[model samples]
Target: MLNKTRGRPRGNPDTKARIAEAARELFLERGYKGTTVRAVAAEAGVDSALISYHFGSKQRLFGQSLNLLCVESTALDQALQGDQAGLADRLLTSVTSLWDATAPTENRMALQDDDTMRAFRDYLESELLVRVAEFLGGPDATERATAAVGVIGGLIFTRSLNPIRSIAALPSAEVRRIFGPALRAALHARARQH
Candidate 1:
């Protein structure tokens, strides 16, 4: 016989957001290795288990805390699902759509915030780049992921922050048409081994 608890676990409706906010503050202050799940829960005034329930692990909580850096996994999956040659186009379209949804002012502000930018890099390395490299599954997958992200990061920065008139004035489709081939080349590059 097992002792069973009845009903779903009860928590504040805002528990997830609260936990994430607390986590972001701590992570920015202490860096990834220094921040603890217990500290985040205490900051948020939630139980430690609630953080696990909502985010699964500290790494995931870190990713969520950097919400501004997120790209929907479904979107990335959809982009990667198609023909090999179209991968760059699909990915650019997916990412650009998300960027287009946010106001340029918001993008600029987020990019300018040193703490937020650091969080973005952390999320890119720990989450996005790792997932992309694993999905590619080759000896050079990490290299390809790095190149792809570099290209995309440059595109985002030029469009949102520095605002190169030539790049920024063009529509997303046109921008994709011009840059997609370069991105595709980066994505498909195989390292020349000695």
Candidate 2:
């Protein structure tokens, strides 16, 4: 029985947005491990080939799945540029709270799953760290800030997988109690040397 429910229909700009939006919603819900390109195409009400045409490939689509770096990077830059006295407290709270259940565990797993984390690492090291360098001071700050961000980000990424490993559940104030002055002094001292 050849059932012809051909998915060919006239799609507009709005329709394209809907398709991408549907794919993103379903992907995050079911996960990259579970959702198929065909399924996303179905949910989006477009041809599977359209998904490929628009996004190129599933891995490329996944990268476009969210716009996160803008918020993540901006928050840190803002905190770093803010009043020095409460800087670490603000940074800790921002980083900790941002990590809480916001990123789907599957997204982190997506990194390990695809072998593209190296690409992402390189991008972050070059682009993201460069932005941090400009915001904090200059090139000298890049190395230190990149390493520090990596440590904090890695810790949070780990905590995402193992809920019990998350000591972030502690009050931001408490976490800041230890991390605040020490980090602030060091970074502030680093900045002042400019």
Candidate 3:
């Protein structure tokens, strides 16, 4: 004879998402070095084993957490697929348009602080710049991609932070006209071979 024990369900359907969300918040607060799986599990209100079970390891968890901020933009993907010429403009335009459309959600109050924003920026570099490097696919692709991403990040930060009224208030077209050349230079700049 076996006794059947009935109680609340032992598992949560949303645990994976909850863990990812907790990991993101912790990464933003503590950064990659400071965050731990145990801490993330505590934050997520689950056992540490669940973090290991779901994410496998801290590095994987960090990667997954960074992915949370990524909103797929077909336009951006298309922009990256064409000729290298005008890529900067296309990339910038696609990014700006997407940002404009999703500004409310992307610029949520929780990400308003400097530390959180810095963390977010670092995550963006890891996620977006790495892909940009892979897309360029050449000897100096990584170097060029870093510079290009830096240009894009600077433009975004300035525009969103509204530090300079002229740059911030300029229409998107005007922005594309002015900053496009700089991004192009970054994307195509050559590194001297050692």
Candidate 4:
């Protein structure tokens, strides 16, 4: 006769997946600041310790849930390299294509709440805009980078989510052609010392 040990059951590979799925759903529903590890654990039917064990932290869990493991940084880095003249075109191509290919669910998460939007903006600034500004390297670099990112972001939001008729009707190549010059101008804005 063996005595029964009472404790939480051992976690299987499936538990991680379940936790991730739960995290994604909660993140989409409640946004980043609103969602907690305890909530995710509840949603996943697991203990909070399991979340810590599996993902280490809420931020890590969020990253896994969103599948955004340095995607923006990598994309921006690639777009920023080689041929400064074509920077706008390359950025438009890379960034638009990326968002266009992204799942609707993930995109919806960005639109969920103020917290989510702030988180998204913060992530974008840290990952892409700030990097672009650093790459440009000038007194006007930050503003120029912001303008460039705004143009790209507006295009993505309009084309992908909101769908403005004029912008939506244009083919990808035409969109790139029409917007490239403005973006290039913004990026090439002259540096000034005040």
Model 4 residue 32 lDDT score: 64
TM-scores for candidates 1 onward, in order: 0.74, 0.49, 0.64, 0.62
- Any runs in candidate 4 off by more than 4 Å, and if so which? 1-11, 14-64, 67-73, 99-110, 192-194
Predicted structure 3: lDDT: 0.71
Q: Which of the predicted structures, 1 or 2, would earn the higher TM-score when compared with the native?
A: 1
Instruction: Give me the displacement of residue 33 in model 2, in angstroms.
Output: 26
Q: What is the C-alpha lDDT of each candidate?
A: 0.75, 0.56, 0.71, 0.72
Q: Predictions ranked by TM-score, top down?
A: 1, 3, 4, 2
Candidate 1 per-residue lDDT, tens place, 173-192, comes to 88788999889988899787
lDDT of 3 by residue, 94-159 (tens): 766755665533444435567667665765576568778888888999989999988877776666
Model 2 Cα shift for residue 134 (angstroms)? 1.0
Looking at model 3, how many pairs of residues clash? 0
- C-alpha lDDT (0 to 100) for residue 75 of candidate 3: 52
**Model 4 TM-score, all chains together:** 0.62
Residue 9 error, candidate 3, Å = 11
- CA lDDT, candidate 2, residue 41: 82
Candidate 1 — which residues are off by over 4 angstroms?
A: 1-13, 30-43, 47-70
Number of the top candidate by lDDT? 1
Report the lDDT tens digits of candidate 4 across residue range 38-141. 89988988888888777777756776776643235445667889876788988988766665566644665455555445555555565468778887886788
